[model samples]
Target: MDLQLTGRRAVVTGGSRGIGYAVGRALAAEGAAVALVARNARHVEEQAARLSSETGARVIGVAADTGDDASVAALAEAAVRGLGGVDILVNNAARTNPGSIPDDDLEAEINVKVRGYLRCVRAFAPAMVERGWGRVINIGGLAARQSGSVTGSIRNVAVAAMTKNLADELGPSGVNVTVVHPGATRTETMLDVAGRRAAASGTSREEAERRMAASVSIGRLVEPEEVASVVAFLASPLSVAINGDAVIAGGGTKGPIYY
Candidate 1:
């Protein structure tokens, strides 16, 4: 249960809330020094302070838009400076808006999800290479396996491909790269989504949530902490067995046979 992660330094992007926040909490709970990254300076810093106070762990917050290269570079620099070094990088920053092939928002989606992830990995992986040990856990989605939203499918699949390629590139240096795909995670944002669904379905929020939960095999939505726990494990030394793999953390993902 130690995870051998005590004192390990980690940087988690999009760490202000949702799965990102949960990931930071999980990592800190495991005794890792964590620096959380988000686009909102005030919110991220507040969450950082709260986490530090609660866990008594070294935690700092940085605000950087992952869609920008220069910002991500600065993020890497600041994170390394704050944590003394980066042993783990969690690529969790993303835009959750639903897109369509006809909508043709592919370029923008690629920028935020695919290119942004690559940017973070590029910025931090070298340090891992230099230190000869690192962990990169890319937050992907189950849409990679499903076929409905082209934007989601492309972005998630792209992240998975990038993770595999990075694992090949960094595996010799003792850096393990992996991707986690979570579906319909239960986070604060989910409440907002549920509220909208309630309005559209002419149902109560509770009923909307229940309908959503019924779609999952577990009869409920997956919690952010559940996904974060998987991510935390993947970010640890104990995850050496799972390099370049996609671990789905969405309440068992209902009846899909994925090899």
Candidate 2:
């Protein structure tokens, strides 16, 4: 199916690696001009170059701290200058689960995932609204649906709430806002995590990964590229009917039924 993404301009935060990188690659492969944003200048640049070379798309890297307001403002300007004008915004830069973190850590996590997402939207969505077309795909986690990490659940749920509100506000202007929930996704980072789990449990990496995949009905962890395909669709004009929705890109969760 043609996603109709060619010539679109996109900015993907946390685009240096993992799911963000995969999303950037997918969009680029589909013929979009992309700007990859992350906190690390070098990593984003390297990845951007690699992606451009691989996909033959115009891809640039911009470094910015999403947790800071000034940084996000600067990111907005830079992305506009780099991509000409942003048509798609992928909010994916966020802190991972910090198990047993102190209560004070809650503010920090919320700032990064929740507030950070808002900041980016505030900075970029106006242009989309003016153009009467845009896509905002917020990368949340399955923790919002299932309870495990308190911080994870709170932040992701907050993101889902923000997505709905933004969708309502922007839908009339042709901007679709949505959240994507990825569960136990397999990426380079996940491979390292699985290896560490294997070492800690005296098991092979494959065994550890299998155990991690047990909860997924697919009987395997969802790959980053798999999630990217879903995001690519959401980032395209073809996804107009899915605004303000939470699309679970995770290999179906085993038990609960979500309407």
Candidate 3:
């Protein structure tokens, strides 16, 4: 499992922490030079430093707001200069604010993940196409496959549609584009959610965690690194076979078979 990723360059949005950080670590471990992009400069830099030290890989942090056009343009330039041209772009930066059925205003939130992802892909994918080699793994959510939040479903399904279209357009150019749907990943945000659940249910945080984990078919919530492992593979040349597909990395949902 060499992944054949040595010397390959990668750009990961939302790399300051959580799932993005985990993906950075995994990619670095597989010997890919990475640019960690996030809005918080200091936080992203610190995480980059740690990942670089641990994996002995070239990892750099670039601060930028993906939802902003100017910021994303600057980000693409910085990534090119840092990693020496992006061979892999992981669109993992997203806003996870929940919306209601009546939905007051989710456009801004949805735009950040949907439009933000599109911005990053637009900025970087062309270069990959020119080089005739690239991997674009867009992070979606399980809501896309189910019916719950209207906004969530819309955005995630939008990502899937975008992936298929990109794959169709880029396949001839050696660029593989795909989307991943992760449900209730084990991250700091999940910890915050568990804490809230604990307070609301008047139970211990540990109990809340168990309750949340038990809801999954795997009998536990999937770790960030677990999801990252999938991204890392999808980010490599080894993943040429999975283009335009939606890989679920949420430790499997309880019931409802998705094929």
Candidate 4:
């Protein structure tokens, strides 16, 4: 299906690696000019160049810390200068969990995922409203549905709420806002995690990955590219009917009837 993304310009935060990178790649391959944003300047730039070469899309890299207002403003400026203007914004930068104390991590995680997403929207969405076309896809996590990490659930739920609010506010102006929830997906980071788990448990890497996917009904971790495919659809003009919704791209959690 034609996603109608040609000539579209997109900004994807946390785009250097993992699901963010996959999203950027998918959009670019679908004919959108893309700006890949991340905190690390050199790394994101290198990845952007590689993506451009691979897909032959006009892709560039911009560096910014989403948690900081000035940095996000700078990112918006850079994206405008690089990609002309962003028609799609993907908010994917966030603090990883399972390490810090849930109580202590709440504020920090919210700062990055919740507030950071708002900053990007504030900096970029007005222009989208002006142009009368835009897509904002916030990358949330499944913790909002299932509960294990307090910080994860709170921050992700906040993103979902934010998506609904933004969608209502911008829907009339031709902008769509949505949130995506991904479960234990397979990305480069997950490969590292699986290797570590294998080393720690004296098991094969494949075995570690199987253990990781045991809770998923598909019996496998969702690939980053698979999640990217969902976001790419949401980022396109064809996704108008899906605004303000939470699309779960995790390989289906085992026993949750989320209807």
Candidate 5:
């Protein structure tokens, strides 16, 4: 399907790897000019160059920490300058420090997830409003619903609320804001978590992964492209009416609600 996204300018945070990288590739496949943002300069630039070569899209990379206001502002400026303007913003950067308990340093999680998201949105949304068209896809997580033992559950819940609030605020300005909950995707983080669970259960990582997969209705982990495809669709003209909605890309989460 032609998503009618050719020539659209997009910025994706944490675009160096995992789901963010997949999302960037998906957008580029639709012929959109993409700017990749990540804290690691070399990795981000390398990925951007590779994507540009592979997809033949105008792909640029900016090294900036989303947790810092100055860095986020600079990233926004760089994206607009590089892409001519920003038509889509994918707030995909997130941190899940399971070791950090609530009583410990909650600030670290807040700084990276909550503050970082807000900073990027604040820096980029005005331009979208001015142009009168934009798509903001926030990568939320299933933790928002299950709030399991994961340390990032609180932050995910906050992100879900922020997604709804931003969708409401930006909807009137011709910007569609939506959140996606990609549950148990095959990413580095997921593998690490699986290993941890395996150690805790005195079982192999593969076995632990299998157990986790069995918990889902589809009986398997989600693929990064599955989530990315949804993101691309949401950014495309096809989903103009899907604002303020949280689409769960999980393999039918273990819940009564459709999610």
Candidate 6:
């Protein structure tokens, strides 16, 4: 499958590691030029260099905090200037701070996940609309559905609503917008979550990982590349008709229509 992505340009937030890096790599593999955005300059440069070397694709690194409007605006401008224009935008940056119930800051979480997404979309979608083609894939979470145990459930729920809203607004402009809910991915963040769960359960991290897997229908954690594959599909021409849909890439979520 060609994906018909050659010569296209994309910007992926949080592209230094984990799911964001995987999506960047996949897009580069499909022959799209990509600008990888992250707060850490060195990490973003390293990933961009690596992906460029591996796929022989044009990959640029831009350092910016997506949570800040100024930073996000600068990043979007840099991407457009570097790549000519963006045909795809992947909003993958997120933040989940850990603290006691009374100390947790839902506002900070929402600022990064929800506001950051909206800012990115606002900065980039106009270009896509003018071009009459775009792909906007929001990297959502399973917490959007199963909110009971998740600490950042509020942020995820807010993102779910925003995703639908953006999809509706952009769909009429030739931009296919969709959200992907990746469950329990094997990323650094997931490892941190597992560690916390282990300490709470009075068990080892290994045991907690096993328990987490068992909780899901599939007895394993989802790989970042697995979610990336879905992202690639959504960004490809094959998924032009999948707008406004929230697709779950979790290893078979616990409840029906988990999104």
Instruction: Rank candidates by TM-score, best first.
Output: 2, 4, 1, 3, 5, 6
The weakest ten consecutive residues by lDDT in model 3 span 96-105
Question: Per-residue error at 143 for model 6, in Å?
Answer: 0.6
lDDT of 5 by residue, 67-122 (tens): 89889888988998999999999998876443324634557877877789889889
Alpha-carbon runs more than 4 Å astray in model 6: 96-103, 149-151, 195-204, 255-259
lDDT string, candidate 6, 39-100, tens digits: 98998998899999999999999999988999988998799898998999999987633322
Backbone clashes counted, model 5: 0
Scored by lDDT, model 4 comes in at 0.93
Report each candidate's C-alpha RMSD, comma-separated, in the order given.
1.5, 1.3, 1.6, 1.3, 1.9, 2.3
Look at candidate 5 and tell me the lDDT of residue 228: 95
* Runs in model 2 lying further than 4 Å from the true structure: 97-104
**Model 4 TM-score relative to the real fold:** 0.97
Question: For model 1, how does the per-residue alpha-carbon lDDT over 157-252 read when each residue is reduced to its tens digit?
Answer: 999999999999899999999999998888888888898889988999989888978768888889999999999889888889898989989887
Model 2 C-alpha lDDT per residue in residues 72-143, reported as the tens digit of each score: 999999999988999999999987542333456789989998999999999999989999999999999888
Question: In candidate 3, which residue pairs clash?
Answer: none
Candidate 3 Cα lDDT to native: 0.89
lDDT of 3 at 149: 79
C-alpha local distance difference test of each model: 0.90, 0.93, 0.89, 0.93, 0.88, 0.87
Error of 5 at 64 (Å): 0.6
